[model samples]
Target: MKGFARRQRSVLGVADALRLGFLGLKARPGRSVLSALGISLGIAAAVAVLGISASSEADLLAQLGAAGNLLTVGAGQTMTGTPAPLPSTAAAMIRQIPPVQSVTATAYIDGASVRRTAEVPAIHTGGISVVAAEIGLPKTLDARLESGTFLTEATIHYPAVVLGAVAANVLGINAPGPGILVYVGHEYFTVVGILQPVTIAPEIDQSALIGFPMAESAFNPALQPTQVYLRSAADEVPAVSRVLPFTANPAHPETVRLKHPSDVLEARAKARTQFTGLFLGLGAVAVLVGSVGIANTMVIAVLERRREIGLRRALGARRSHVAAQFMIEAIVLSLIGGACGVLFGGVATLAYAAVTHQQTVVPAVAPLAGIAAALAAGSIAGIYPAYRAARLEPSEALRSGE
Candidate 1:
């Protein structure tokens, strides 16, 4: 009886508990698998949320990150209806601030993409300066020169255009056509050179980036550039919004201000904090549900294997031995289910990345933590049942069969 305690996990290493737990599972594989499925569902739900949540978080981060780095300042709110967008001059003003470095401004026409049918009615067509490159956006947006080079300040200030990848694909502008003419508002411009394709927001489809002055005159003559962007040294970016009048305040008291992208990133971080609690709540509910399965399986295993427990107890086994064995089985089931779920979650993440063409994010510690928690939950569920099994009297259990 004294030696029986030596065989249990309290004395036995983790490796022994695992081996015995797995052995129990192998002996009753069908029942083990059924029990595992319950936990699998719980893990799957948790992992699914994790995968999608991660993707959404990243997209939001990317946008917000863009805003922060490509530090834009402008009058955020417009008159209720008109929403007079931010003026480009705000960027110049922002640059005047001590911490600020270089700045570029663009006034977006956001012209309705002209099309014969409603399927593709509007695509973004706007103007930007070659100077816009310096203002925090060039690297992330990998627009390469395919047939022609990037627009010069001289070329960009005019109607010379660069097409986005999807835009180029949609507008049938991939190859340089001999007699290609593009019409925006019945106005026509010759296709100079086809710029390479890249990722941009969907709202700006069939879009072309032209020279600043050309875009302003063609799309918005009355308004100055609504979007003003600038670059500060990395360490200097923090002070930029505060230093500038247009961006210093939240309500935007000045003539021009736009929400800096960094604000969006901070908001995203707050959202992740909120979402983490939500996900944990969901996991807790799952753990609760999984506990029921663990309890049910352990109870049934105890009843069905009463003879085995009785024999083991009679063979110099201690009460602790039987209890430990039962608990180990439940824990093993949970851990195995968790491992499978992690693999499943990884696959799901890859699929999402493939379909969306976005980067695949793998949070290394989350899966392991998820599994450990499930095992803990299962152990807790098995406690009562294991206690009952350990307390069973062999003579009374034998007489019950009679």
Candidate 2:
């Protein structure tokens, strides 16, 4: 009698489990595809958000880096309301600092207005001013001569002057040489060069520049620098900023105004972080909606396949086999969607980067993390349906299907 008894099979082999899992999907291709699509949309949204944000941040950081290590020092009003001026040797003193790369100064010549002709109406000043610049001015500002040459030792004491981009436009002087001249103050200064628009110092755009020596003799014999620009090593910017005011004017440190472009760059980076967080939240909501869709699809599958479950159980199928079958189906469906979503997101990110002229930057973890999340969601959604299918008694399930 014992020899006639049947052998019990408690668990399924890996190959058999996979075959069973795929059978259900193959039987209902349309339903499986629709379910997978929902998950794909969610994964695409998350991946795209991470990719675009990373690329945008990289572009912004690169632009900020282009601003270089620059520091600007200018004069401020004293407690007595007097305009405190920088010392004549301010540039020389700043250069003494080891981290300081180079220094240059410019003095604003008061009551100077440039004009196309001395006959141009005084009221039509064209909003241009005059400044006495040192020989190292262009190097300090990192500016280039668009037309001619910058101030030289021989040209400094003469009537030679350089026009800024805006100043040139204002005076209607396109080409500068020996013949082209613009009236600066009461003197006729020959236009030796024209400078491109300056990014570091925008005020230069609306000002005419002459040599320090010429500015002293013609406009101000007691000429002193009103502003000083300096360059330093990248790591020494903060340390240099703190000691700059005292370095420029040990006598009137309180009256010295010190500023850096790096501060503005940092503020901009902080602003970008806020937008990234908002987009990430939207992506999360999309993923949540996908999980719901998966759960609904799995529930329907269980309800429609009662006959199948009953027949398998009537044979040799166990509860664990049934559960594993449905669970694997869910996971496979999710992975399909996730893979398609990754492809779509990668394409979208590349297209955007090309249009915006920025380098494409995709985080390596984005795709891997997205796939893992999809699998987790699928497994969680499959649990209740798998349990319901496995709990049905074979005779009852078969009869209900009839």
In terms of lDDT, the best-performing candidate is: 2
Off by over 4 Å in 2: 2-5, 26-31, 60-68, 80-93, 96-98, 104-227, 235-239
After superposition, which runs of candidate 1 have C-alpha atoms over 4 Å from their true positions? 1-21, 44-69, 75-99, 109-113, 116-150, 153-159, 163-181, 190-208, 213-223, 235-253, 350-361
The 0-to-1 C-alpha lDDT of every candidate, in the order given, reads: 0.62, 0.85
358-398: candidate 2 lDDT, tens digit per residue: 88988998899789878887888788888888898899889
TM-score of 1: 0.70
For every candidate structure, what is the RMSD over all alpha carbons to the true structure, in angstroms?
6.7, 5.9
Q: How high is each candidate's TM-score?
A: 0.70, 0.70
Residue 109 deviation, candidate 2, in Å?
A: 9.8
Local lDDT at 313 for model 1:
66
Worst 10 residues of 1 by lDDT: 128-137
For model 1, give the RMSD to the true fold: 6.7
Give the alpha carbon lDDT tens digit for every residue of 1-402 in model 1. Answer: 775655543354567766877787798888777777767766766675677667767866775544555565554554553454554455555656776666655555554343323443344333311211222233433335466555565765654555545555656666544366565444555555555533322222345556666665666556465555566666776666566654433244454454555565676678786886797678668767877887898898888888887777667667887788888888888877777766777777778877876677756665876687677877887798889988998776555534
